[model samples]
Each structure stands twice: as structure tokens, then as C-alpha cells.
Target chain A: MSRPSTRPGLPRRGVLRLAAAAVALPAAAVLAGCVPADHAVTDPGPGPGGAAEGVEGRVTDARGRPVAGAFVEARGTGPRPNPVPEIAVFTDGDGRYRWFLPAGSYAITVTAEALGRRTLAVTVPHGRAVRLDFVLG
Target chain B: MKPFHAIAMASVLALWAAGAAASDRAVEAGVRGPVPGPSAGEAATAAGMPYAGSDAVSETELAASGVTLGTAPVGPLPAEMGGSEVILNWDSRMVLKTTLYPNRAVGLITRNGAHHCTGWLISRNTVATAGHCVHSGRGGTWYDRRTMRFYPGRDGASSPYGSCGVSRMHSVTGWTVNGNRDYDYGAMRLDCLVGNTVGWFGMYSHTAPLNEPAIITGYPGDKPQTQWISSDKVRQALTRQVRYRMDTVGGNSGSPVWSDRGEALATSGAWGYAIHTYGNAGAQYNGGTRIVSAVLNNYINWINRP
Candidate 1:
């Protein structure tokens, strides 16, 4: 199936452009805060109207194959509030999923039948893309 | 010059007066009574079945024992101007007495043996929950009914009312197709009439359901199979959603955001105002899809579906 916009209200082009830019930049320069992109910011502070940051990730099994239809549940681990919906997103044919959420800490859990579940805690920075991948055995 | 200013102020006063009048009309027109579905006694009598199976409480015994409903009275609606803004209060507790009224109505939902979400009974064989609980939105398809189960009055490791398998699940096109959060409510048809013994919550709607006591009872994933509860006032009531400061986690998605009216037979025992959905929003208030006419009507139809 064609991958739909993982984050509601954000165009697919914006996510693709961010992904592409992340690839082109040298890791050392990007880490040193030299790369300038609309969604690449170091500060995790709140933006205007509590701007949403992007969270895109992939899920795979222990065998390193993409695990399609794995349920990815995201919950805000809040000291400050994060507004992610309770609706769990699933991986596409490529085992990739993306979500835009208000910048805050989140506990993302990936689960599928027989493969078990794995949870990762990540703090989403405002106006940036955070990658969170999972491997279920 | 004084006359000109007076004319301007008068024009402003006239507009304000008109607005206030409309606001009053809206509040008055918004008041709706609860739909108290069959009580445990009534349901048992109608079905010709024994009441209170598996540690459940019988309505007759509960009434005779003088147990309180523990619901708030029907309070007056606040002024329409900024009425939705309520004081944020976050406090929740574990409910040890899950077999009582209103508590027994709530249920734990399991999708393929894993604790997924919460739901509540609206009829003998019908339940109301979040749309996402029944069908994953947008990129996801509807969940298979065979893999889903509902357990009423389920304490940790002790299911007082047993469990029922889903016969069918129902959701709106807005959620199933468009993935709209405004229409994030759904219902399920249970294979058995578990609600007849465990009871159900009546739904209440008001045009301006602001400042009303909001209670959420559900099994949070953090707590495993146990049920927890939180209570506060409706902070904000939009056209299709209501916001509150009640503490909730992921599995509390389909929990009923209801206000108890304390009268089971005389009026509704409790009235569900919204179906809890998403987590906290920009303003830090968690919310759900408010039960407007369209939503309530859809639930009523689903409750009666074969």
C-alpha cells in the first residue's frame, strides 16, 4: 500500500525533504549544528502555538526483515504535556511509520503477535525530526 | 462630540445585548435528560435470567442495602461566555469496588489477549468506546471482531462479570475513512447480554455541558487489568469535543467521560457526556469526542442493532 501522511496536517513532501536533507549532510556537521533546515533545531523548547515535531521510525524483527502491520503505540511521558493521539499507528509495507507530535517526552511501544513488544523512550525536540526504530524478536 | 460617542457606545451595547440573549437561548435549548437504560433488576426480569452472576451485585440487593450511587447532582450550566474554561485538576485513584453501580458498567477491552483500551455498556448487548479502539484510523483497517474481547467489572486477575466476545464493531466514516478526531467514537455488539447483569451507563447531553462533573473509569495499561478512576469538571466544551483535566493514560482511550445523576430509576443513574480519546492538547487539557445529537443518535441505533 502507498504510504500515507503519518502526521496529520503535515504534508508528505515536508517529511521526505527532511529525510533527504538528513542523508546529504555529514553526521559530524549536522551534530555540530551547522546544517540549516526548517525542522532541524537543537532546542527542545516550546515553539509558537506549541508547534509539533516529527517522529519517523521503522520496525523490524530479529531477522532484520521489515515487520509490516506492527502496532506502534505512542504515549506522552510528561513533565510538560505532549499531545499525541491514543490511536496507535502501524508500519507500512516498508516497516516505516511517521508521526507529528507536540514536542515532549514519549514512550513508544511496538508490538505484534508472536514477536513480543519493545518500548523506547525518546524526547521529541520542537520543530525537528526524531528517529525511533525498534527491533522485536 | 458627546452625542457621537454616546451613539457609538449605544451601538456596541445593542450588539452585546443581542449576543447575551442568544447565549441564554443556547443554554436553555441545550439541556437534555439522561436515557436511563434498563436497570439490573429490569434487565434480569426481562431476560428471565438470574441477576449478579460471578460476584456481581444484584440491583435489588444493592437498593435494599442502601448503597449510594455516588454521583453528583445535575448542576446549573455556567454562563456561555468562556463557560468551557474549567479549573484543571488531576487526581486519580484505584477503584477497589468495581462491582458497584457505574463502575460495573465500565469494561476492559483486549485486542488479541493484550490489554488495549477501555469501554462501557450502553445496553444489554451494546458497548460504547473510542473509534480507534474498534478501528485504527487512516492508514489502518478495522480490527477483526474475533480477536477482540470485553470484560465487565474486571478487577486485576478477577473478572467479576466474566467476558464477552465482540459480534460486530461499528464506527463512523469520519474516523474509519477520514481519520477525523472529531468523530472518534464507536460501539460494539457483544455476543452475550453481559450488561443485563453488570448494568450500563445512561448517556446525557447538554448544549453547553461546561463545569459539569466529569468522571473517567477505565483499565489503564500501566495498571494491567485493574480499573482506575479520575474526576474533575468539564473544562471546555467545543461543538464536537469536551476537555478535562482528569488523569488518563493510553489504555483509557474508550473510557466513558460521564457525570452521575444519582438516580437510577427516577432518572438516569449516570450520563456519559463524552468518549475519551486523545491525550493532552496544546493547553494541557485531555479531551474526547462530545456526545452531540448525531453521535448520540448513532449510538442509540447501534445499541438496537441485531
Candidate 2:
């Protein structure tokens, strides 16, 4: 992302001159685009919460065994004005939670109040089903 | 006078003239507020926003005072995920790292100017960032010099067009005054319209599952003037909270904990929650500060209201 500039007194001409100067310095562009974008998992099918579109996952302990009654959540992110909704649910006796979510980018967090908490941030594309598993200590 | 001295004098005069003209334009544009840049002492006033004693003012009074104390805004996702999902999409060999911080990093600048950090603009003028970035001293008072204005997409001292002031500031009731890590989020009311800039990110109302993939973004001091993004492997999930590993350092404290679509899920807080390490080695860990419906509603009401 580009940081905004706050220099007080540059006219249009001055701005052009600065732009020219900046171009002369190749490192400026490199520095300008320094931060890398996030690479997250994208949803390939219907998002959770949609009819026949949801996330199914199991919460387990470090031993790779199922842990019952884990809390599961589905979240999504988007531009301003409108954004995806965040949803939450609890696991069944089989330690599974099926969350229905709108199609978009989401960050998921799961917690077993009695046991512990864990989080996963991902994107749920449209018409796709994503599965996540949590292992607590 | 020597020739070099004469040249230097001319240059200084030209620079002064340019600065004066710019100041005049800013005033005409209504960007200039009554108070000049806030001093360090003034930034400390935010610490005062949250009262410590029982005799302190009520939330109503604080709201009247223009101090917005509540959660961030949450909204629905876009119909289409069309924008660039990745920052550096061309690079395929790069691998994102996950880290955590024991102490949250907050960006502080003078009141008038913008403070640069990876923060989320939850409202038109309200922003959510780490409390440590805004406060200092034993009581964690807001620091003025460091409390510069905020420019979401800032490039060093330049803020192009986007600029906002700290009209009001709010944080979790207890964390505001006591420096509690569990609730390390802080919100600021802006003087300008954030919508004109990079725009604000929406909050999530529903809960998310643990052990899912996540991406983190922020501007690191080591690489100032630029933003960094990283993806972490989902480790586990506990009750009410989730833990994950990401590569983060000091200056990234105020960075937004965002979902894949750039929506902010939580503000980076202390090292960790419960037994997990908030900061292990050099990585930072974050717990989900659920943006449920009620919390999101409160945040929206606060920012949307006059």
C-alpha cells in the first residue's frame, strides 16, 4: 500500500518535478511497493451459510482425536459501504460445526471455552465449501 | 557576501514562500482546525478520555464529549470479489511468514498530522488500532508528537489527499486506563472523511472457526512507507478465542487483523490469549476479538451518529 504524502507547499509543477525526480531514482518505486499482499486460501465453491453451502470441520486435541463442543465461527471481509457477515456456531458431539456464510473472504476462529481457542483466517469464495480442523491443547 | 551564501539564502526564501502558500491553501480548504498540531501533553489527553475512578463521567457524557467508546463497524461482504486480492501477485517464490508481539505497537503522531501505521478505518472518521501506539507514560497516556494524523495509505510524511484528525478516541473500558492486553483495541474519530482515502474496512459480526488459513497486513518500521502481508497456518481454536502464528514485529502492533477480503477482524493486541504465547521468538499471535452483531451495531451507531 502507498503511504499518503503531506508535504505542504508543492504546486502542480513542483509535484511533476518531484515525480520526475522520484522516477530518476528507481529505488523509490521499489520502496513505494515494498509491502507484499497477503496470500490466503481462496474459496472454490459456495460459501458457508448458503443453502447446501457451508463449512464442516472438526475440533480436536493435540492427539488428533475429536474434541466435542467446540465453538466455530465464519467471517468474511470486503470493501467499505458493504462487507461480508461474520457467523458463529458450536460443534456437535462429533466435534463438527457447519457454518452457513455468504461468499467472500473470511477469517475463521474456533474456541472450546472449557478447553482452549484457535483461529484460522481464510477466504470463502462463492458456491464453494471449505473445511477447517482445529487442534487444541 | 560569498556567492554560495547568497544562493543558499535565495533557496531558503523560496522554500519559505512555498510553505506559506501551501498553508494558506490548506486553511481555505478547511483542513486546518482551530488547534495547531497537538503537543505530547495533548495526546496524553486520550488517557483521560477513559476515567479511572468511580466518580468518572458516564459513557453518555463521554459520547457527548465526542469520545467514541465502542466496537468497530461490521458490514456485509461485496457481491463480487473483484479487486486485487494479493498485493504482490507477480511474485510466486515469496513465502509469507507469521509472527507475534508481546506488546502491541501503536502509531502516535501530533494531533493535526496523520500517524502512519497499519490500522483499520472502521467508520468515516473512526479508526481502530493498538492502544500502545496512541498512549505512553505510566498511565499509558496518549502521546502527542507520535500522535500524528492517520493516513491509511501513507507514504512517509506525504499524505497525498487522505487526512483525518483525532476528534474522539475510544477503547475497551478497562484497557483504556489500565493497559489491559486482553482488550488492546482503540478507536479514533477522524477530522476528515476517511471515505475519500483508502476507505474503511468492515467488521465481522459472526464468529470464525479456528485452524483455518489467515492473512495479516501491516507496515513494518524496518521497511517504512510500505505495507506487508503474510499468511499463517491455522494451529488451533479454543473457547471464545482462536490462536495462530504470524511473523510480526514492534511497529506492526496497530496493524489490523484482517480477513482475506481486507476486512478487519480484530486489532492486533498483546502477545497471546490464555496459555498460548502472544509473542514467541519473533512471531506474533492474535486472538479473535469477535465482532458479533451486537458489538458491530454499537460501533456503527457510534460512528454514524453526529
Candidate 3:
């Protein structure tokens, strides 16, 4: 989700100060990263009124064993990388990655550890989280 | 919290040129504003233009390519982002590519056949880089003192937008005089409007702990035919500097630390918040001068000059 713009914009000549401790706003979701053991997850939750949405899922081996540190890339079918993403991330020890994308269709690529790689397409709806799990062949 | 104080725009340039330290550090402007392009707000809208979202390729396709991918997420990136962190990927590799919009607008700047640094286009003809890129005030004070060359989107042997050569450059007094890393930002003016074709990034000024996902993109001298981009989270957001864990190399000195802030915040599709200047792999922290520094506003004014 996007950060709120300064209301009325910066006065023509006067500069507006960005709010300190702005992390208090809905955090941008961690697309993919490692979560240390015993550490609490401060996931940036959905934006106000669920105006936006996110996707979360796990990656596993064909044998169904969870995989971690696998590379996951989410590319929007747009003409350009754009405001959304042509972004790549890695799964965590729990074999999971989560993202709050501006509503759009996405082609996600997962590069499994030692098993090779695969790509999947999904259209995320507004105001919700979509779950899609994959088994690396 | 660093208190915000607006300085007189005109006096910023005068103070810098006349050797007055505006703050602990001072910046010099290159090309006066309002340049012939979108106002900062309009550019922010361009920066925030939305994407529809890319599709699936086969495992065989992945096997056939040789592109290196990143392994970490947007937290604190490894210090000294260059070296092993930047590996080449094949799918996104430059072949007979065409669009130069954002990538090509970023360029490889070289001097003395040895100094390789990165820079980004802010207007049709101006390039913004680290002040140390233009002049390393190392020891006492010493500029590159050599002719500089720029290759926009130069991949291996290919130059997508050809090369741009110009000498009109500017740097902040802190860097030019004392080599202070906090004030390490610079800008250059080209003779032609390369940005009119390539498009440029918009600028924004904000305070600490933005904690947003950020990407540091640049032409790394270590990689072959590749522009390395490491996506990570912004860390240690001080009033004067922004830090990230994205991987970068020596040549990436002036790379842009860009974030996809919204239209209300960033103005362009994704706005660059800082001018990447240093890397500290061991400490696991790399940083650059924040774009919001008053010195940069002076460059915005300089570039906008009629």
C-alpha cells in the first residue's frame, strides 16, 4: 500500500516536514526475507479499510518438504516495472513470503534450492490476501 | 528528532560558493531550476504511475539463462553491498533492448580510466552523483582533476543511449572542502537534453525511519553487461543521510537509492531519496546523502534555470 500524501501538498514556498516515526503508518509488507528465530514479526498489516491487498504462500520440494531462502520474484505484466513491482524476494525458514501489492495481476517466479525454478501467475483482488503454495519439481 | 528549518534558496548558493557552511555540511548546485519538465509534483505523479504486474517462464528457460538473483529481503542489507552480493541474471540482461526510461537515465561515469562511479538524470541534461564522485576531498581537498565520461545504460560493450560528455559540474562545500560523507552529493549538466528522451527521476525530502522498501540501482564495474539492483529496506534514516543494506560496488558511488513512494509523497513513479556514497560490508551498513538536503534544492533551482 502507498503512503498518504501531505494534505494540500507542500505550501507553494513553505516545505512540509515528513512526520517523524512515520513507521507508525501501515508498514510496507516484507515481500520476502528471513525472520530470525524467536523474533516477533512486525508485518505491516493491510492499509486502512483494506483499500489494498497482499499475497502470502509457502514453497516446498516435490516431496512436500518446506524450503527456505528460495528466490521469489513478482513481476507485474505491465509495460514497465512501474509503481507495483518487477521485484524478487526470498522465502523464509518457514518457506513463506508475503506481499501487499496494489491490486494487479502478478507472475511470480520461485527459484527453489537445488531443485531449480518455476513461475506462476495470480491476480490479487482488492482488500484481501491471496494464498498460493507451490511444490518445486 | 532533527528539527526542520527552511533556508533561503538564493542564499544557499551564495553561502556555498562563498565558502560558508550552511550546516555542518553544505552542497553546491548544478543547473538552476525550474527546469523544462514536470514540476516536482507532476514528476511525483509520474513516479507513482501504477503497473498492471510480468508472466511465467519454464524451468528450462531458467536453466538456459545465467542471471544471478538476490538472496535477502529488505531489512538491513549486508554492509559493503558490492563484491559477491551482485551476481548477473540472464532473463533481465540487456540484449538488443530499447526502452531507456529509468535505467538508461542512470549512467556510468568514468574519469582517469580508473574512477568508475554511478549517476542519475534529474532533468533533460543534468546528472546527479556523489560529491566525491566529482571530487574526492580526501586528505585535505582534491578533485578528480580529470576529464569525465558518461555512458547511459552501458552494458558490457553496448551503450543504449550512447555517451554524454560535459564538464559543467557542482558539489557541496562540505565535500569539496572537507570530504565530509554527510554532504557527499553532486550534479552535472550535459550539453544536450538526453533526459528528454531517457526521462529522469523526481526528488523528495523526508525525515528519518521512513522504513520503506528501497532499491539501489547502478552500473557496477564488477559485473559484466549488467546493472546491479539490490532491493532492501531503508535503515538508519537520519535527517542528513539514508542507509540501506543493498549490495553495491566502488563504481556505484553515485547510484540512486530509490523507493516507490506514492504520488503524494514521491512525485515520480519511484523517487530517489538519497545519493549513495559509501559501503561498509563488515558493519553491514551502507549510506548516502539524503536527497532532501537543502543543497539539492539548489541544484533543482539551477537545473530549472531558463
Indicate which candidate wins on DockQ.
Answer: 1
lDDT of 1 by residue, B1-306 (tens): 554344445545545533322231111212334433455445332221112222244546444433322232211211011123233346677776776666777889987666778999877777889887876554345666777888886788877666788877887756754556787788888877666555676664556878887888887665657888888888888888899886676678899887654433223355677899988754778898887765665665566444
Q: What does candidate 3's lDDT look like per residue over B1-306, in tens digits?
A: 232222233233334443322332333322222223443543332221211111122334323332111221111111122334424431112222223335655777765333357888776566778766654332222333335666665656556555666546666555544445666777776655455454676555544546876667676544443566666677678767777776554566788787546332212344677888765512356677786646555556546544
Q: How does candidate 2 fare on TM-score?
A: 0.39
Residue A21 displacement (Å), model 2: 75
Superposed model 1: Cα runs more than 4 Å off: A1-82, A87-132, A135-137, B1-89, B262-267
Candidate 1 predicts chain B with a TM-score of 0.72
lDDT of 1 by residue, A20-107 (tens): 5454343333333421111100111222222235578999988899997777777778666566665435677888876554467888
Report the C-alpha displacement of residue B257, candidate 1, in angstroms.
0.5
What's the distance in Å from true for residue A110, model 1?
A: 7.8
Tens digits of lDDT, candidate 2, B188-233: 6666543322234444432444555554455543343444555563
Q: What part of the reference interface contacts, as a 0 to 1 fraction, does candidate 1 reproduce?
A: 0.15
TM-score for all models, in order of appearance = 0.58, 0.39, 0.49
- Per-residue CA lDDT of model 2 for A75-98, tens digit only, reads 344441112112114566677765
Name the weakest run of 10 consecutive residues (lDDT summed) in model 3 chain B.
B48-57
